[model samples]
Target: MKILTLNFLTCARKACKATNAAFPLHPRDAELEIVETDLNPLFIRNILPRIEWDALREICVELGLPTLPDAAPEPAALFAEPIVPADTMQDADEGAEKQPTQLLQDLHRLLLETTIATGKLVCGNCGHEYAVKEGIANFLLPSHLV
Candidate 1:
């Protein structure tokens, strides 16, 4: 678990670094941060439509994330949020109007490019803790858990 924890943080850091590189004028030295969540069943239900709830839940549990609710909820909520600093955004030239399309591009960079460089991911279901090292997740299941 200790090794896994270090690996998770390493992955997270790499992801964060990649994300920062994709943005224009983004802070080069921003530190990566991880948030551990204890997701309730209602929250899981709310996220079902937008995300692969089963997969996410499984990963969460395997990584020791918070457990979600049993009954899936209807009308999942939007999970989109600005993960980067507003000040890091590069504005268009003096008279140029900002394009809406770029926003989507930025979001994509933030979400996909970022890697969980090093950290521990605990499973919510079985209390398994997978370690992320060098931006890699060791999700190998133990003999009993497998």
Candidate 2:
């Protein structure tokens, strides 16, 4: 599943529901695949406001993926400004083009390109396991859990 989806998912167990720690289920033994797609800057900008930066960073660290900045830029600034580096102008004048903003590239890579092909998401609170296989994360809980 897309890492972006994890931003909204929480543990399904009745005991764990509606808790901050229960959301952003911890991934275990994750087999990740990178499938690139056309980058849509607009979509990335739109979604920035909703993403839980700390949770994303934690999951990336758990999966041994490259970590993001300790804090994300303000959503307003991301949407309103280019955020070009100080040296980008010099590079541009030297006949080299500045690439997409680093934040945009990282967000796209993490949220779009990366997929959890095999793994299990464990609830931080209840320790319930949601198995992921064949690139699909099964979030359905047992009847007792429901």
Find the candidate with the highest TM-score and give its number. 2
For candidate 2, the per-residue lDDT at 104 reads: 73
Cα lDDT computed for each candidate against the true fold = 0.37, 0.82
Residue 44 of candidate 1: its Cα lDDT? 35
What is candidate 2's CA lDDT for residue 98?
Answer: 29
Candidate 2 ranges beyond 4 A from true positions:
75-99
Model 1 scores worst on lDDT over the 10 consecutive residues at 21-30
lDDT of 1 by residue, 1-146 (tens): 22112222221222333542211111111223343333233333332355433443443344454565554333322233334446655643422422223333322222333335566554333334666566555756556554
Q: What is the lDDT of residue 87 in candidate 1?
A: 66
TM-score of model 2 vs. true structure: 0.80
Q: CA shift at 126, candidate 1, in angstroms?
A: 1.3
Worst 10 residues of 2 by lDDT: 75-84
The estimated TM-scores of all candidates read 0.34, 0.80
lDDT score for candidate 2 against the true structure: 0.82
